[model samples]
Target: MSNFWKRAISGFLFVIILTGCIFLHPICFFVLFFIINIVGLYEFSKMARRMEIYINLPIYLFCGSLLFTAGFLDAYIGYRDGYLWCFLATFVMSIWELYRKKVNSFQNLAFSYYGLLYLSLPFTLLIYLPYMTSDEWRPEIVFFPFLLVWFNDTFAYLFGSRFGKHKLFPRISPKKSWEGAIGGGICTIGAALFIAPYLEGLTVYNNIIIACIVVFFGIYGDLLESMFKRNIEIKDSGSIMPGHGGVLDRFDAVLFVIPAIFVYLEFVY
Candidate 1:
């Protein structure tokens, strides 16, 4: 099959599964994202090892899962102490590093925890997003950022390639341009206006603010992932998604955008 077909097929499945799990049942969403969380951790761990950047792989995976699972429990069950084990893992990690005597224990521990802080925490924040505006699990609320981000990304690429002149960030992502970003932002803001009514309770004003937030922070997340890939001198995060690359590659913007959206909604409502 052509690359275009591959991307189209996988992308279709990706959208269907995400929307299905989200709207189907809260437990389905939890189970699906739990797998995504673990896969993302595995991909990061594999990347780190490629550069001889060793980490306690087993501990890192466990802690990362614990982080997401804790957030899930807290959000679903209203249990507050789910994070206790996650906090305890840090101290346990330090002590665990003592016996193996790996080179640069500090760096090892730093990167180990970095995976959790960078990847896992952001995903955990996603679980709490539906609850930000409603007491119940609203799949529409959870899927808001995805819509804006996808709209912004598509237009950004379209405009970037055609009218792009000035680089947005030359050192990291040279292909990105101010024109593309502006174009994407304009289109995404328009989308938010359209999306407002479907969200039931949120006003158009709040939706516009959210679209703006996603446009700005989604770019940041993309660049951040680019920096990581460039630093490691790899083309993609992993090959799990064929044309989409890895789960992280596909959701990098979503990760960074989630935390920001969560904060904004929390403050606003």
Candidate 2:
């Protein structure tokens, strides 16, 4: 199959599965992201390993799972204290490094924690977002940010391909252009305006602001992941998604945008 067809088919299936899981029920939402969290952590560990930074994958996964569960329970059952366990886990990692006689023990320990913060924390925040918008769970709150990111990415690709004049960041992501980024921001803002009424508690103005946030940070997220790939001398994070690369490749923008959106909502609402 052509790369275009492969991309289209995989992207379609991904959207369908993700949308279904997100909107079906809160448990499904948690389960889906919990799995993503683990996969993303594994992918990061592989990347670090390629650079000779051997991370303890099992310990990272266990700690990350604890953090994810803490965030999940906090969101669903109103138990905020579970986050304390993440701190305990961090201390345990430090102690474990003391016993290991590896030369890069500190590097391993640091990246393990970094993986947790980079991949796990954002997902934890995502699980908590739906609960913040309403007294009960509201998937639309979770869904809208994704919609903005999708529109931004789609329009950016289209516009950049058509009228791209200047590079956005040639060093990291050569294909991205300033024209495309602006076009994406405008298109995302339009989507926000159109969907504002459906999202309770967010006025059109607020939705526009949120879309702007998503666009700005989403681009950075893409660039950040690109930098990682460039440093590692690899294309795509992994091949799990066929044309889309890996979990990190698929969720690079999401990892950045979700946290920004969560912070925005926390301050505003």
Candidate 3:
């Protein structure tokens, strides 16, 4: 099949699976993302190795998984100091490097921590978002930010391909244009307004504001991932999902937007 068809089929399947898992039940949600968390960290580890940064994969994986578990349990049960213990355990990598006597121990240590902060922490924050809006698990609250990010990405691609004249950041991402970004923001905000009635607790204005946050930061997230690929001189993060890329490539925008939305919700309510 052609690339377009491949992309379309993969995108469709991804949307279906993600929507079903999010709305199905909280355990499914946890299980799905837990797997994603591991896959993403593994991908990052590979990338770091390509750059000759020898991260301790086993420890990183263990610590990252622990971090996810802590976040998940905290959201499902209640806040706990156990998360601090997990956070501290991440530092064990540094101590491990001290004993290994490797040439680039410090670099490995840094990359190990960086992977957790960049990939794992944001996902952990996502586990808490639904709980923030409601005491009980509400898929709608979880779905809202994702829906906005999807709309922004879709509109941006469409607009950029059609009428892209000025580059948004030619050095980092050549295809992105100011026109595309603005078009995406406009479409996403409109979508937010349209969907406001359906989502409880979030007013129309709140939705609009959240949409703006998603669009603005979402672009940066895309660009940042592009920068990572450019730095590594790779076409895609991984081939885990054909036509889309890896977990990092697929969820880069989600990763960046979730933290901001979480902070906004905390401040507002």
Candidate 4:
């Protein structure tokens, strides 16, 4: 298949599946993203390993899963002690690393914990977002930020391709342009306003601020992942998708955006 067709097909299916899961049921969201979380962890481990870091895949995945599941249960059940589980798990992992006897085992330990913090923590907080955004569970609240991101990305690409001149960051992402980022931000705010009423959680004003947050942090997330890939000497994080690269590539923006939005919603809620 042509690259464009491959991208279109896979992107369509991903959106469909993700939308279905988030709207279908919390369990569906949990199961689907759990898989994505694990795949993303593996891809991250692969990248870290490229730097000659020793990664204990099973232990790291287990730790990541521990954080994910515990947080999900807390959100799902209204329990408030999830952080205790996370902290205890971190301490245990650190203790185990001391006895592993590998040379420079601390690097391995750091990478494992980093995987948990970077990949696992964001997803855990993402599942918490709907609960934070609404008085009651609303799937639309869960999907709102995603819509903003899509708007920003789509318009940014269109505008950049047509009128791009100055590079936004030539070293990290050569294709991005200042014209695209601003155009995208403008469109994102408009899109947020358009959807704000339907959201029924945050006001239109709040949503606009969120639109701004998504654009700024989304670029940081994308660039950070690009730097990771460039340092590791690879194009995509993995090949799970025909054109979308990997789970990490697909979710790079999401990882960063969720936390920032979560913090904002926390203060406002």
Candidate 5:
């Protein structure tokens, strides 16, 4: 099969699994996110190791598990204690790094925190979002953020490839262009507006604004991940996904937008 067909089949299977988990009850969704969190953290730690910075894998995994719990199960509290726990995990990992005589630098510590910041934080937004809405409206609000990001990414890649000229951040991501960013934002926001009426009990104006914010921040999210790859001098974050790269590559926008959206909903709602 061609790479395109292989990717299509894999993407289809992923969507089917996601749809099944999300609709099967919050528990299923939580489990799926939990597994994703662990796998994602593993990929991150492996990447760090490549740089000769050893992160305590057990600590990172534990923190990721707790983050998944806090977001989905709410078996733990939200940002306050969850964030503290993550910091503690970082601290412990730093201590471990310190003991490894061969690796010692402020940069390594920063890298450890960056891994958690990149993966765990935004994931919290995803797991928590659905529960924030009224039961009747949860599904509408919950999935829209992810859908918006995906739409923005899809449109951006397609439009950019066809009509791109001016670079958005040439050093970070050469393929991305300002034209694509603006075009993608417009298209995804249009979709949001089209679907707004179906989201019963949501304020249309507020939701539109929120949708725009998600798209805006999501663009930066993609760039930030690109920055990481640029700094690391790597083509992709990982090769987990055939055509897509790693979990991080696929979720770069989510990492950028999720926390921002969570904050927006917290203050606005």
Candidate 6:
């Protein structure tokens, strides 16, 4: 089969799984995210190796497991301590790596930490959002962000390829255009406005602001991942997804945007 067909099939299955999680229960969603994080982290560590950079993978895996556990606790128990522990554990691991004279490369360790921030943390935020409250709006809270990001990406790719002229950041991502970025933002924000009222108890204006924040941060997240790819001198982070490239390529925007959204919801609500 063609690459397009393969992508289409995979995308369909993923969307089905995500939608099922939304409709079924938050546990289902958490399970799916946990698996994704494990696979995604493996891909990231492998990518690091590909760049001739090596860190203790076993330690990294341990840290990732802690993150996953802490994130779940934060989601369900309102545990502020989870994040605190995450930081402390990561620091201890870093220190241990420093003590290991066999691998004295700070650069590799730093890059690995960057991956945690860029990939694992944001994903945790997404997983945590739905469990923030016990309201009916919980599902919408979880679902809308992903929907907006997906819509933003689809429209940006479609419009940018058709009429892209001005480059957004030529050095990091040559294919990206400012025009498409703005266009995608407009589309996502507009959809948010339209969908905001349907959300259980959120006001239209509040949802509008949230939507704007999501779009803006989402764009920055995409740029950040693009910068990483450029630094590694690779076209894509990995080839897990046929057309989408890698988990990083697919999820870069969510990595940045989810955390911002989490903060916004915390402060605003």
Each candidate's number of clashing pairs is: 0, 0, 0, 0, 0, 0
lDDT of candidate 5 over 201-221, digit per residue (tens): 557786777678877888887
- Candidate 2: C-alpha RMSD to true structure equals 1.1
Model 6 deviation from native, Cα RMSD in Å: 2.4
The better candidate by lDDT, 3 or 6, is: 3
The Cα local distance difference test for each model comes to 0.89, 0.89, 0.89, 0.88, 0.73, 0.78
Candidate 3 Cα RMSD after full superposition onto the native fold (Å): 1.2
C-alpha RMSD in Å of predicted model 4 compared with the true structure:
1.4
- Which of the numbered candidates is closest to the native, going by highest TM-score? 2
- Pairs with steric clashes in candidate 4: none
lDDT string, candidate 2, 1-269, tens digits:
99999999999999998899889998998888888899999999999998888887677888999999998898789887778987888788788778777678878988898899899999988887767767788888888878888999999999999999999999999999999999989999989999988888778888988999999999999999999999999998888898999999999999999999899889887
Residue 3 miss distance in model 3 (angstroms): 2.0
Lowest lDDT block of 10, candidate 3 = 97-106
Model 1 whole-model lDDT (C-alpha atoms):
0.89
lDDT of 3 at 24: 97
Supply candidate 4's per-residue lDDT for 181: 95
TM-score to native of every candidate shown: 0.96, 0.97, 0.96, 0.96, 0.88, 0.89
Backbone clashes in candidate 3 total 0
Q: Give me the overall lDDT of model 5.
A: 0.73
lDDT of 4 at 226: 96
Model 6 C-alpha lDDT per residue in residues 1-269, reported as the tens digit of each score: 89899899888877888788776876787787787787778788877786777867777777776787787776666576876777887888788776777553786788779768766877777766655444332777788888889989988888798879999888878889988888888888899888976876567876787778777888888888787777777888877778678778877887777888888777765
- Candidate 1: give the clashing pairs: none
lDDT of 1 at 70: 92
